[model samples]
Target chain A: MIEFIPVLLVIFTGFSGIMINRNIVMKLISLDIMNTGMVCFFVLISKMSGSFPPIIHSLDEMNLDFVDPIPQAVIVTAIVIGFSTLSLSIALTAMVIERTKKVKVDDIEKKVGT
Target chain B: MFLVLNFVYLFILFLLVLLRRLENLQIFFFVSFMFFLPFMKNMDEIFEGIGGVHIVFDDTSRLFVLMNVLVFLGVSLKMRGKKKIRFPFVLTFITLNFLYASADLFNIYVLLELLSLETMILISSGGKVKQFWSSVKYMIFGSVGMNIYLLGVGMVYMQNGTFDLTKILRVSNVSLVLIFTGLLVRTGFFLYGMWLPSAHSSAESEISAILSGVIVKGGIFSILRILSFEPFSSITPWITKVSAISSFLAVIFAITSKSFKRMLANHTLSQLGFIMSNVETAPMYAFAHALFKSWLFILADELPSERFDEMGKRLNLFPWIFLILGSFSIIGIPGTIGYAAKSSLFKNTYNFERFFLILASIGTSVSFSKLISRRPKISGWGGIKENLHNLYFSILVIGGGVVLFEFRMKSFIQSFLLFIVGFLLHRMIGKNLKELRNPLERIEVNLFVISTLILGMILWLIS
Candidate 1:
C-alpha cells in the first residue's frame, strides 16, 4: 500500500495544477501534467511486482519474473488518447483566443459577456 | 456479429466523413438506419460477450443505443438544408455506436472522452463566438471530470488488478465515489449542472437537441454498473436524494430563467435529476425526456430570440402544434409519454421521494405553463411538413403514452391536479417570472467541484 502513496501524490498535484490555472493554455498544460501523472500512475502500479517487460512468443516463455503487461498496454493507449484530446483542446483554445484575443478565462468572460 | 456490424457502420461513416462530397444528409441517414436494423431484431434478449470477453450487452445498453440512433435520425432530419454542419454531425455519430455497448470501465472512459470531444466539436461547429464559449466551458469541466475518472480507474485497478466490469475482486468506496462524481459532473447533477444550461443553450438548435436528449447519458451505463456491485452499495441511497434535490432545484431555476433556450436547458437538467432518482426505470424517463425535450429545442430555435419578454408579445412562424404536444408531454398531462414514464417512476418509489418528485413535476408544469399561454402567429399552421422531425417525434410521444403499461386512473388524477396547480401558480407569479433568482448561480465552478468531491467523500465514509 505504501507504493500507492507516490502515485496518489502525483495525481493530487496534477489535480491542483488544473484548479489553479486561469489561462486556458495554462489550464491545458496543467491537464497534460495531470494526464501524464495518471498514465505514470497506471504504469507504476504494475512495476511493484517486477521490472522486466513482459514479452513472450508462446505460453512457455511466460514467467513470474515479468511485470504485468496489461497496465503497460493500457498506459500506451492512454497516452495516445491523452495526446489526441490535448491537441483538440489546443485547437479549440486557439479558436477561442483568436476571437477574444485574451488568454485568461476571466478576461475573456468579461469581453464576451454571455 | 454485432461487432462486424459496428465495424461496417464505422467503415461507412469514415468514408462519409473523409470524403466531403459524399457527406450528403441522406447517406448519413441511410447508414444510421442500416445499422439500427440489427438492434431492432435482437431486442428481446441479452447478447453477452458477443465479440469479446470484456464487452457485455444487456437491456440498459439496448435502450440507450436505440435512443442514440433514433434521436440522431430525428435530429438530422431537423438540420436539413443547413450548411456547414454536415461533417461534425456525421463524426459525432461515428464514436457513439461503441460508447454504450462496451463493458470495460476504462473503455467507457475513452469512448466517453471521444464522445464529449466530438460533441464539443459539434457545439463549436455552430461557428458563433457564443457557441465557442459554451463549448469551451464544457471542455473544461469535461476534461477535469474524465481525468478524475481515470484516477479512480487507477485506484480500482490497484485494488482489483483488472479493468473488466463483470469481474471485480474489490472496489474501495473512495474510488467509486470519485468515479461517480466524475460522471455526475457530466450528467448535470444539481450543483454540477452549471455547465449544462450554458452549453445547451448556446449551441445551434439541432445540436442542443441531441446533446440535451441523450449524449450526456455517457454516465448512465457506469452509474447503473457501479450500483450493482454489492460491496459498493453504500452510496446507493444518497443517489436518490441528490437527484431529487437537483430535480426540484433545477425546475426552480427553469421557472425563473428569462432566456428561452436557457430555460429549456434548465428543464433538461431538472428532468435529468428526475431520471437519475429512479435508475431502475431511467430508460423510460430518459426516452421520454429525449423525444420531447429535443422537440422543444427544435421549435425554440424557430423563435426570434430567447427573450421571454418579447415572446409574450408574438411568436411569428412558431409551431404551436409541436409546442402544445411537447408541453403536454413535459407537464405530464394524462395522455402523454411523460405521464406514463413519470407514473411508472413514481409507482416504484416510496411516498416521500415520490412526493418530492411530484413537487419537481409541479415546478416543471409551472415553467412550461407560461410558454403555452403565448400565442404564435398565423404562419405556424402553414409549415408543418417542413419539420419532419417534429411530426416524427410527435407520433412517438403520443403513441408511447397509449401503449405504456403504467396507465392508471390514480396516476392520471395526480398528473391532472399537478397541471392545474402549475397553471394557477403561473397565473399568480404572472409576468415577473424573469425577476426570480437562481440561488446556485453564484457558485464558482472550480469551488463547486471541490465541495462536491468532499461531499462525496463524506457520504462514502459515513455510509
Candidate 2:
C-alpha cells in the first residue's frame, strides 16, 4: 500500500547513507536506521490486515478487529536484538577510536596501510 | 520442561551480565550443560529440535555440547588474572547458546550476526592494525553474504508465506535454487569465504579458537538445518553432485595451504564441503567436526612459543597418545570419532561420491602432515603448570574423540581400512610435496574470477 512508501524511503536512505558515508560512525548510524526501517516495514504490513491492536479485553464484547500479532511479536524480538547489535557496534567503534583515534574509515585505512 | 530450563539458563546469563562478574561466564556454561542434562531425560527429546520438533537427540549436537563445555572449562581455568574479560567473553557465550538453541531461518541469521559482531570486537581488541583490516574485510564479506541471503528470504517468504523451516520443508522446488544458493554463500562454500583465513588466523589464539570453532560452525548448522528439513526431493541429484565437486576442490586447496592456522582454516572449509556432500551423513559429521576442530584450534593456539623448544624435547617423552588419538580422529582412523561419520557417509553415498570422499580424506591427511611436520621443538625449561594444563586439555579432547568413536564402534570399524589407505597415501605424497607460494597472492582479481568460474563450472558439470 501507499502507506508503506515512507518506510521504503527510509530504508533506501539508510542504504545510501551506508554506501556514501566515509565516516565509520555515520555508517554505523546508517546501519541502525536501516534496521529501524525494516522493523517499521514489517509493522506497517501487519497493520494492513487489521484496524486495531491485538490485545484482548474481557469488558468489550463488541467486534473489535485486531491485527495479526505474529509479526508484531517478531518485530519486538527484532527490536531487542537490534538494540544489542547497536550496543556492540558502538563498543566496536569506541575500540577503533581508542586505537586509531580517528572516526573516518578512509583515514583509518590510510593509517593502517590497507 | 526443556524450554523452562533454557529460560532459566538465559536468566542466569542475564544476572551474570548485570553483576559484571566474568568468572561466572564459565559457571554459566557449566550451568548450561546441567540444563541440557534434564532435556536429555526424555530420550525422545534428543531428536526433537527447534523447528521440526522431531524425535531424535541429534548425536552430533550432543557431541558438540560436550566438547564445548569441556574446552570452555579448560580455557576458563587458564583465564585467571585477565582483567576486563567479562563483557566480551559473556557476550560470545550468550551468542553461542542462542545459536545452538535457534531452529528457524531468521533466528539463525540474527545469531550469526551477533556472533560476527562479537568476533569483530574480540579481534579488534588486540589493537593490531592487521587485525582491524582483517575484521573490516570480514565485515564486508559477511554483509554481502547476509544481503544475498535476505533477498533469498524475501523470495522464499513471497513463495511459501512462512519462514519457519518446518513449514518450508513441506513445500518443494518453488524457490529451491534461490534457497540453496543463499545457503551456499552463507556456509562459506568455495571461494565465497575468501576472508576466512585472514580473519580467523590473524586474531589472538583464544579468539581464533572461538572464531574457527564456534562462528563458522554456525554457518554449517544453518546449512545442515536447511538440508534436513527442506524438501530436497526435487534437487537431490543436483545438490549431491555439486556438493561432491565443491568438496573435492576444497580438499585440494586445503592440502596446498601453509601456515599452521591458515592451513587449519582451509581445512575447516574443506571438511565442511566433505560433510555437505553426503547430505544424509552431514548433520552428524558437521556437528562432530565443529566440536573436535574447535578444540584442536584451541590446542594449537595454546602451544606456548616460549616453551616451543621444551615441548619439542618432551614431545617424545609423553606417549604418542594425544597426537595419535587426535590425528586418528581427524583422519578417520579406526575406532576414532571421524570413522563413525565417515562410515555413515560412505554407506549412504554412491561409488563416485565415495571416491571423492576418499580423495578428500587423503587431502586432509596430507594437509595435517604438513601441520605435524612443523611442530615446534620443546625445551627443558617450560614450566610444569603450563605443560600440565596443555597436557590435560589435549588429552581431554583426544579422550572425547575416543569415547565418541567407541559409542559408534561398529560404523567406525567398517571405515578402518579406508582410513589406513588414506593415511598411507597422505604420508607418501606429503613428504615429497613442495609448498606453494602464499595462497594470498592468488586472491588477485583476475585469479579470483577465474577460480570462481572454474569452480562454478565444475559444480555445474558434477551436478
Candidate 3:
C-alpha cells in the first residue's frame, strides 16, 4: 500500500508540475515525469505477482512465479515511444527558441494572435 | 493474411514514393488503388488469438477506411505543389488506416502517438517559427493525452488480466472516466480543444484538413469502439453531453472569430460534435464531414490572407463557387449531404440533447453566415485552374445526399427555417460581433489539464 502511495505521489507531482509551469522545457520535463510514473506504476503492478524477471530458461520448465512479461514488454515499448516523443518535442522547442528567442509561454503568447 | 495485405498496400505506396519522385498522376493512381482496396475486404472478420490484443475489421471501420481514402484522393489532388508535405501526408494517411482498424486500447494509444507525431512533423515542416510553436503545443498535448490514456490502460489491465477489449468485462467505472477524459483531449472536446483553433489554423491547409477532418476522429472512433460494449454503454449519454457542450462552445467561438481559417477550424469541432452526439449514425456524418471540410480547406489553401472581410472581394471564380457550395452543404440545404447527415443524427436523439444538437445546427448556420452572405466578385484576378480535382467533392455534396440517403421530407422545412433564423440572427448581431479573447488562441496547458482533472473528479463522483 505504501509503495503504491509513492507511485500515486509521483504521478500527481508530475501532473501538478505540468499544470503550474509556464516554461516549455519545464512542461516537457513534467510530461516525461508523468510518463515515467505511469510506466513505473505498470511495472509495480506487474511485479505484484513476483520480483523475478519473466524469463524461462527451458521450454518445458515453466516458472509460475515469474512476473507477467506482456506488461513489461508493453512498458519497454512505451519507454521507446516516450523517448522518441520527448526528443522530437525538445528538438521542436529548440527550433522555436532559435527562431523567436522566447522560452517562456507568456512572452510567446503575446506574439501569436488570439 | 488480411493484415499483411493491408501492409502490402501501404508498402507499395512507400516503395513508389521512395523509389523516385511521385508526380500528381502517380498520386492519383495510388489513391485510386487504395480506394478500391476496402471493397475487397471481408466484413465482420476478427483477427485474434495471436496475442492478447483484439483486432477486428467490421462494417464501421471498413466504411471509415473507405471514407478516409476518398478524402485522401481529394486531398492528394490539392497536394500538387508541396512535394515535401506529400510524403508525411501519405504516411499519416496510412497511419490513419491502422488507427481505424485497432480494437485494443493499447493499439489505439500507440497508433495515436504515431499519428500525432507524424502530424507534428508535418505541421512544423514549414520550418517557420509560428508553425514550430503550434506543432510543439500539438506534441505536448498529444503526449499528455496519450500518457493519461496509458494510465487508464494500466488500470484496465490490472483489473482484467488482458488487454483484449472484447474480453474486458465488469471493469470499474473509474477506468472508463480516465479513458474518456484522456481520449476527449485527443478528440478535441470543449476543454482540450483550446489547442485546436491555433494548431488547426496554423498548419498548412492540407495538413489542417487532415487534422480536422480525419485524425481527431481516431480518438472518437476509439471512444465509440469502447462504448459499443454492453457493460460500458452506460457512459454513452455523458459522451453525448460532452460532445454537445464542445460543439456549442466551438460554435460560439467560431461565430465571433474574424479569421477565416480559425472559424473553419472551430466549425470542425462543431461538426465533430454533430458526429459524436449521435454515435449510431457517426460513420455517415464523419464521411460527409471529411469530404466537405477537406473541400473547404483545399479552397482555403488558394486564398492569400485568411480574413473574412477580404474573402468575398478577393476570391476567384473557382473558389467562390466551391465556397458557396461547401457552405450550403455545411448549413444543410435540402439536397446536400449535410442535410441528410444532420437529419439522421437529430432523428435518433431526443430531449435536451436533441434540443442542444438543434441549437448547435442552427449555430452552425449562423457561423457559416459569414461565408454564405458573401457576394462573389465576378472578375477573376487570378485563375485557380490548378484545382480542377475538387470537382469530385462538389458533385458528391450537390447530388450525393439525396441519392445516398432517403431525403426526409419532414425535417426539410425545419432545417430551412433554422437556416433562415440563423441567417437573420447573424444579420442582426453580425455588425456587433467582435473577436472575443479566445482562451484557445494560446496553448493554455495549465488550464486544460486543470479542467480535465475537475471533469474527471466530477465524473468520479457521478459514477
Candidate 4:
C-alpha cells in the first residue's frame, strides 16, 4: 500500500505542470502524464493481493494466488478512454492553431472577442 | 448485464468517432443510445454505480438522467447541421453519462479527465487567447484536485482494502476526515476551486452552459453519493457547520459580482454550498438543482449581450413572459421549479440555518434583478420566430420541473415571500446600468476571495 506513494507524487507533479505551464501542448501532455500516473496507481492497487494475473489454464484448477481481475479490466477500459481523449485534445490543438495561428493559451485569448 | 450495457454505450462512442463524416447519422445513433438506457436489462448493476444501487437508481438519479437527456436534446437541436463540434461533443456527452453511471472512485476520476479534455476543445473552438488561457488554468486546477482526490482514494483503499464506496461505507469511522478533505478539493469547495470563475466565465456561452450546468454538478454528485453512503447524522457536526458557512459566504460574493457570466459562475459555487449543507435532503434536490441550474445557465447564455444596446432598445411584449418565467424559476417564486427545490432544501436543513438559505435566495434575486434593470427596451417583435422558440424552450423546462415534481406547497409560499423581500431590497439599492463595471478589476477579485473565506470561517465558528 505504501508503494503507491510515488505514483501519487507523479500525479501531483503532472498536475502542477499543467497548472503552471502556459503552453497548450505541454499542458495537454501534462494531463496525459497525470492520467498515466492514475493508471499506475490503479494497477498497483490491483496487484496488492498478489503478482499473478487472473487467468486459468485447462490443465489447472482455479489459482487462488492470482490478483483481482476486476481492476485490470477497468484499467483496460480507462486506457482506451484515455487514448480517445488524447486524440481529441490533439484535434482541439490543431483546431486552435488553425483558427488563431498560435498555441500559447494567453496569446489565443487576446485574439478572441473580449 | 449492467456492465454489458456500459460497454455498449462505450461501443457506441467508438462508432460515433468512426462515423464522424456522417454527422446526422451519428447524432441519431447517440440519441438512440440515450433513449434505450432505461430499458436495458441488468441496468441495476451498472446503475448501482461504484458506490452502489441506492446512489444510482434512486429517485434523484432518475431525475438527473431525465435532465441530461433533455439538455442534450436541446443542445443537439441547436447544433443540428453544424459539423464542426458535433462528433467530439457527442463523445464528451457519452463520457458524462458513463461518469454518472460509474460506481467506482477511479472511474469517476477517469471520466472527469475526459470531461476536462472535452471542455478545453469546446472553449478553444472560439480560438481566443483569453479562452485558451482560462482553459489552461482550468486544466491545471482540475489536475491538482484530481491528484489530491487520488491520494485520498489511495488512503481509503489502504484503510478499507476496497475502492468501491459501498464496501468502504460498511466499515465505519475509517479516516472519514481524509476522505472528506480529498472530495472537498475535487468538488470545488472553498479554497481549492478558485480556478472555476476564470474558466467557467471565459468559455463561449454555450460551452459555459455545460460547464456551469453539468460539469460542476458531477463533482457535487460524487461528494453527495459518498455522504449518502454514510448518513450526515453520523458525521461530526463541525463538518456540516463548515459547509453551511462556506455556502453563505459564497452566495454573498456571487451577489456582488459585476459581469453577467462571472456572477452566474459564483452563483454555482454558492448553490453548491447550500446543497452541501442540506445533504440530508432527499438527493432529489441535488438532481433538481442540476437540471434547473443548467437550464438557467443556458438562458443566461442566450441573453444576447453582443447587441445589448440594440436589443435593449428593441425589447418587446412577449419576451417579458420568458424573463418573468425564468426569474421566477431561478428565484424560487411560488409555482416555479426553484420553489420546489428550495422548499425541499429548507425543510430538511436545521431551522437555525435559515439565515444562510434566506441570504442565498436574496443574492440570487438581487443578481437577476440587476439583469432585468439592464433590459433593452422593446421597439417591436421583429425577430418573433427566434424569440418565440427560446421562450417556448425556457417555459417548457421551468413548467415541467414544477408540475411534475412533488414540492412542499407551504415551503414554496414561504420561499416566495423571501424572494419578494429580496427583490424589493435590490430595487432600493439598484445602481445605474452604465455605472456598473463591465470587466471586474483585480481589487474586486481579492475582495471576493477574501470575503468568502472570512464569511465561511465565521459561519463555521458560529454554527
Candidate 5:
C-alpha cells in the first residue's frame, strides 16, 4: 500500500507540475516525471508474483518465483523512447531560447501568436 | 503471403534509404505495385498464431490501405522537385501499411509510435525553425497519448493474460475507458484536438496532406479494432454521442479558421468526428476524404500564400476546375463519393441522428461553399500543359467520384434541400466571416496532455 502511495504521489505531482509551471523546460520535466510514474507503476505491479530478475541460463532454473519479463521489457522500450523524447524537447527548447530568449510558455505564445 | 509484402516494401525502402541515388519514377512504380498487391489477396489468407503478430486483410483496412496509396501517389507526384523527403515519406508509408495490417493491440501501439516518429521527421524536414516547435509538440502529444494507451494495455494483459486482440476474451470497463480516452487524444477529438491544427497546418503541404489524410486515422482505426471484439457493446452509444458532439465542435472551430490549409485541417477533425460516429461508413469516408482533401492541399500548395478565400481568385484554369471538383466532392454534391459516405449516415440513423447529420452536412456545405465562392480570374496563367500533376490528380478525383457514387434518387432531393439551406445560412453568416476565422494559440504540450487525460476520465465516469 505504501508503494502505491509513491506511484500516486509521483503521478499527481507530475500533473500538478505541468499545470502550475509556465516554463517550457519545466513542463518537459513534468512530462518525464509522469512517464517515470507510469513506468514505476508497471514495475510495481509485476512484483506481485515474484521479485527476482526475469532471467534464466538453464531450463531447470525457471520457476514460478521468477518475475514477469513482459512489463520489464516494455518499460525498457518506454524509457528509451522517453529519453529520446526528452532530449529532442530540450533541443527544441534550446532553439526557442536562442531565437527569442524566452522559455516561458506565455512569452513564447506572445511572440509567436500573430 | 500478402502479409510479407509489407516487410518487402520496408526492405526496399531501407535499401533506398541507404542507396540515396534511386530515381523518383522507380519509387513511384514500386509504391504502385505494392498498392495493387493487397487486392490480389484472398480474404481467408489472414496470418495469425505466429508469435503474436497477426495480419488480417479485412474490407475496412483494405479501403483505408487503398486510400493511403492514393494520397501517397499524389504526394509522390507533387514532390518531384524535392528528392530528400522521399526517405521519410516512404518510411511513413511502410509504417502505415503495417499499422493497417496489424491485428494485435501491442503491435498497433508499436506501429503507431513508429508512424509518429516518422511523421516527426517528415515535419521537421521542412527546415523552418517554427516547424521544429510544431514537430516537437506533435512528439510530446503522441508519446503521452501512447503511454496512456500502454497503461490500458498493461491492464488488459493483466486481466486477460494475452496481448493478441483476437485471443482476448473480455475487456473490463476501466480498460475500455482508458484505451478509448488515450485514442481520443490521438485521434484529435474536440478538447484533445488543440495540437492537431498546429502540427498539421504548419508542415509543408504534401506532409499536411498525409497528416490530415492518413496519420490521424491511425487512432480511429485502433479504436475500431479494439471494439471489434464486441465485448463492450454498451459503450457504442457513448462513443457515438461523444463523436457527434466533437464533430459539431470541429466544424464550428473550422468556420473560425483564417487560412485555407488550416481550415482544411480543422475540417479533417470535423470529418473525423463524423467518421467516428458512423463506423460502418468510416472506410468509405476515410477514402473519400483522402482523395479530396489531399487534392485540395496539393492545389493549395501551388499558390504562394494559403490565406482563406484568396487562392480561388488567382488559380489557373487547371487548378480552378480541380479545386471546384474537390470542394464539391467534400460538400457532398450528389454525384461524388462524399455523397455516398454522407447519405449512408443519414439513411440508417434515427430521428435525432438524422437531423444532427443533416445539420453537420449543412455545416460542411457552408464551409466548402466559402472555399468556392470567389470569382475565377481568367487570363495570364498557363494552361493544362504546364501542370501535369494537377491534371493527373483531377482525373483520379473524377474517376473516384464516378466509381464510388452511391446516391439514392430520393436522397438526391434531400441533398438539394440541404444545399439550399446551407446556402441561405452561408448568406446570413457571410457578413460575419471575418470574425468567424479563429486563429488558435498553441497550448502547452504537458498541460494539454493532462487536461485531455482528465477529460477522458470524466467521459469514462459518465459513460
Candidate 6:
C-alpha cells in the first residue's frame, strides 16, 4: 500500500504535465509518463495476491501460491499500445515542427488558425 | 468458423495492399463480399467465450453491419486515383466490422484502439499541416481516453476477476462510473468532444463522412452495451439527463457556428444527445443518422470551404438539389429516412425528454436552413462526374425514404410543422450568427479527462 503512494504521485505529475504544458512534444512525453504510471499501478496491485510466477508446470505448482496472470497479460498489451501511441505522436510532433517551426500549441494555432 | 472469416478477410485485404494492380477488380470483389455477409446469418452462437470473436445476429448488429457496408461502398466510389488511400480505408472498415460484433470487454477495448489508430492514420493522410495537427490532437485525446478506460478495466478485473462482460455478475458503482466516463469521453458527449469539429470537418468529404457517420457512433454503441447489464440499468436515467443537456447545448452551438461543415459536425454531436437519452430507439436513430449525415457530408464536401453566406451564392444545380434533399433527410421530413427514425423516438419517449429532443431536432433544421441559398436564375452545368456523384447520393436518400415508409401520416404533418417553424426561426437569426471556436483546446481536453474521471469516482462514492 505504501508503494502505491508513489505510483499515484507519478500519475498525478504526468496528468498535470499534460494539462499545464503548451508544447506538443512535452505533452507526448507527459502522456508516456502517465501510461507508465498506469502500467506500474496494474503490476503493483496484482502483487497483493501472491509472490510466485503464475506458471504451473506440475501438479504441485498448481497448489502452490501464484500471482494473477490476467493483469500481467493486460499490462503487456497496454505497454505495446502505449509504445505505438508514443511513436506516432512523436512522428506527428516532428511534422508539426517541420511545418510551423514551433512546438508551442498557441504558435501552431496562430500559424494555421484552425 | 465465424472467427476464421475475419482472418480470411484480413488476409485478402493484406493481399490487396501488397498487390496494388487490378485495384478496380479488387474493390469490386471486396464490396460484393461485404454485401454478401448479412445473409449468411446464424442464430446459434450469439454469446461466445473470451479470447474468441463474439458476434450476434440481433437487430442492432444487423443495422450496424448494414451501415458499415453502405459507407464502405460509398467511400470506395471516391478512392479511384488516390495514392495509398485504399489500404487504410479498407483497414478501417474491417476493424469497424469486427468492433461491431465484439461482445467481451477486452475485445471491445482492443478493437476500439485499432479503430482509433487507423482513423488517425486516415486523417493525417490528407497531407495538409492542419490535418496533421488535428490528427495529432486526436491521437493525444484518444490515448488519454483509452488510458482512463484501462484504469476502469483494471478496477473491473480486480473486483470481478474476469474481463468477460457476460460472466461478470455485478460491479461496484466506482468501476461502473469509471467505465461510463471512458465511453463518454470517446463519444465526445458534451464539452469533451472539442476535437470532433476540427478533426471531422478538416478531412476530405469521404473520410469526414465515415468519421461523422460511423466512428463517432462507435463510442455510443459501447455505452449502450454496457448500460444493458441488469445491475447498471439504474444509470440510464442519469445518462438521459446528461444527454438532454448535451443535446440542447450542442444545438445552440450548431445554430451559431459560421462554417457549414463545422455546423454539421456540431449537429452530429447534438444528435448523440437524442440517441443516448432513449436506449430502445438509440440503434434506430443511429442507423438513420449514419445514412443522412454521410449523405450530407458528401454533399457539403463538394461546396467550397468559404462561409455559408459566400459559397451558397452562385451554386450549381447539382449541389442545390441534393442539398435540399440531404437537409430534408436530416430534418426528418415526412418521406425521408430521418422521419422514420425520429418517429420511433416519439412513439417510445414521453414528457420532458421527448420535448427537449424535439426542440433539439427543430434547432437542427433551423441551423441547416441557414445554409440553404436560392437557386441562381442561370445555373451552370457542373462537371459531369461530380453531378453523377450527386445523383448517386440523391438516389440513396430517396431510396431510404421509399424503403422506410412505415411511419404514420401524423408523423409527416408533425415533422413538416416543425420544419416550417425551424425555417422561420432560421430566417430571423441567420444574419446574427457568429463563429464559435473549439471549446476543448489541447490542454483543456486533458483537464476534462481527469476531472471527468474524478467526478465519476465521487459520484460513485456518494451513491
DockQ of each: 0.48, 0.15, 0.64, 0.20, 0.44, 0.63
Chain B superposition TM-score per model: 0.92, 0.79, 0.93, 0.80, 0.91, 0.92
CA shift of B334, model 5, Å: 1.6
Residue-wise C-alpha lDDT for candidate 5, range B108-202, written one tens digit per residue? 87787777778888877887766777776777677667767777777787777667887887877777776776777677776665678777888
Docking class of 3: medium
- Candidate 3 at residue B264, lDDT? 90
Residue-level error in angstroms, candidate 6, position A107? 2.3
Tens-digit lDDT string for candidate 6 (B322-394): 7888888888887777888888877887787878888898898888787554564356666666465566556
Tens digit of lDDT per residue, candidate 2, span B1-463?
Answer: 4544665777777776768653545566666667676554454233234322232234455544555565555555555445455577667766665566555667766677777677777877677866876676566445445543543454455445566766763443424554555456555666555667667667766677667666676777666666666464456666567667666776675665545566666677677777777766776676557555655665564443322223342343232334445566677765555666666677688777767777777677766654344433433544666555356555654554556554445555545655556556667775555545334322233124423543464465457
In model 3, the runs with Cα more than 4 Å from the true position are: A58-64, B25-41, B312-315, B380-385, B440-463
The runs of at least 3 residues in candidate 2 whose Cα sits more than 4 Å from the true structure, single-residue gaps closed, are: A1-69, A72-114, B17-28, B43-64, B159-161, B168-175, B230-242, B302-325, B373-463
Q: Where is model 6 more than 4 Å wrong at Cα?
A: A1-3, B1-3, B25-41, B47-57, B376-389, B449-453, B460-463
What is the Å distance of residue B296 in model 5 from its true position?
1.0
Q: Highest DockQ: give the candidate number.
A: 3
lDDT-wise, the better of 1 and 3 is 3
Pairwise lDDT winner, candidates 2 and 6: 6
lDDT of 3 by residue, B191-231 (tens): 66466777888888878888887887777788888888876
Off by over 4 Å in 1: A56-64, B21-23, B41-53, B229-233, B316-318, B383-385, B434-444, B455-463
Best-to-worst order by lDDT is 3, 6, 1, 5, 4, 2
Candidate 4, residues B279-331: lDDT per residue as tens digits?
66635556556555655555554555633333453344445556656666777
True contacts kept of each: 0.41, 0.09, 0.61, 0.20, 0.24, 0.57
- lDDT, candidate 3, A18-75, per-residue tens: 7688898998898899889998999997987887777778876575678877888778
Q: Write the per-residue lDDT of candidate 5 for residues A3-114, one digit (tens) a residue.
A: 7688868866876676578887887898889889878877886786688887788888777487777667666877777787778778877876788778887787667552
TM-score of each: 0.92, 0.73, 0.94, 0.75, 0.92, 0.93
The model with the greater DockQ, 1 or 3, is 3
- Model 6 docking grade: medium
Candidate 4 residues lying further than 4 Å off, grouped into runs, are A1-114, B1-58, B169-182, B231-243, B280-282, B300-319, B351-353, B374-376, B379-392, B401-413, B432-463
Interface RMSD of 6: 1.8
User: Please, what are the lDDT tens digits per residue for candidate 1 over residues B409-456?
Assistant: 888798889989988999998567554544443224544565566566
**TM-score preference between candidates 2 and 6, better one:** 6
